[model samples]
Target: MNEPGYAIRAEQLTKRFGDFIAVNEITFDVKQGEIYGFLGANGAGKTTAIRMLIGLLSPSSGIATVAGFDVYKETENIKRNIGYMSQRFSLYEDLTVKENIRFYGGVYGLSSSEIRDKTDFLLKKLELEHARNMLISSLPLGWKQKLAFSIAVIHDPKIVFLDEPTGGVDPITRRQFWNLIYEASSKGVTVFVTTHYMDESEYCDRVSIMVDGRIAALDTPRGLKRIFHASSMDEVFLKLARPEKVGDI
Candidate 1:
């Protein structure tokens, strides 16, 4: 059984696509109000695992609970308790910023008045009040990314999943996005994020590195560096990615 305080718990979670194994049996826990980073390279099964957690994809075998709801039985409860932002911006390109928020808020079942109030606050916080009426396609990439994140959490879910939220943006924009994530975490929103960028992993409270569909290591960034005897996550990743030598542990 999972402990009372964990926001997410998974035991031997596995996912298979026909003959190929996308995610091997992996187990981990994410605490409440934590910023947990899932780091892995392309084809490393990060997305497949995340999909299972968020109820987007069912696992082949295993037990998993997110926000205290079982992934297999109470998927609707999990969906209601969590928010998700994918790599592709989820907003409609033709809709204005405010309109996009309105649409998503409606889908989440928020009252019109509630949506309006939350939209106002988000626009101010994102400094997008001037562009509230601008079409989503007209906004800069950074602004779009920020807006997408804001909409994802507009209903104030207990947990939010960000999948490569800053994929192609500049360093400055990525830093700014991290600030938003930190703000959300401070407000007691648990953040579960996956990223290929090594530097971003440093911003997390704890990180899990996935290699070949399994979690190879899980620890705080500093602890991981100390254990691996590396100066940066890039080096740590390289060390883990290298082939094991003869007689190696």
Candidate 2:
């Protein structure tokens, strides 16, 4: 479990390339064991902000920390304590399910014995025992997503960054995937996720909506709905994303 207070913290976080600012000065705190939804449309800077938080991209200014490690100086340390699952379903299509698990474990510096043990555990936990030796390409999209997420947290990282982890899956699979997320949160893992799905945003403990590289709204789902005088998160998003359409709501 993380210490009391925030598992992730940012202070006036900003990122820029030349004269164009990709991520404006945004600040927020994500508590340990909480599911935080980072919502924004394409080109709204959600990805840039996530890259900075995970230490994939350096910020032009401001300070941030993940799992208690500084983004600038302790990027390696940060990577070791956090897991990542991208929307692209980052799994090798030719590798068998078991092989992929072992490969990721090795990448995280796990011993051979540890990799073997994790492979056994994940297969059972994710109910993939029947397909353990099957090539990833043969699995359905839902299975691939579950396997990708399982591999990401194989080492039990303190925090996990999920970049649109449920893009194209069906409703049933999405619900099942969220159950997995809830299970991880129950075990004290901070889940930082980014998505354009409005219903997905409602599942978060709190959400932040970005507009043109700036956080226009940051609050709990209920709080945001109440503040925006809307009926749902979708309405809140529409209101914030298109302020001129507030009257339409």
Q: How do the residues 36-149 of candidate 1 rate in per-residue lDDT, one tens digit apiece?
A: 999988889999999999989999999999999999989999999999999877889999998999999999999999999999999999999999899999999999998999
Query: Top lDDT: which candidate number?
Result: 1
For model 2, residues 1-249, the per-residue Cα lDDT tens digits are: 245678899889999999999899999989999999999989999999999988889999998889888999999999999999987779999999999998999999999999999998889998999999999999999999988998999999999999999999999999989989999999999999999889989999999999999999999999999999989899999888988877665
Give the clash total for candidate 1: 0
Model 1 bad stretches (over 4 Å): 244-249
lDDT of 2: 0.92
Tell me the alpha-carbon RMSD of every candidate.
Answer: 2.2, 1.7
Look at candidate 1 and tell me the lDDT of residue 231: 96
Mark the regions of model 2 whose C-alpha exceeds 4 Å error after superposition.
Answer: 1-4
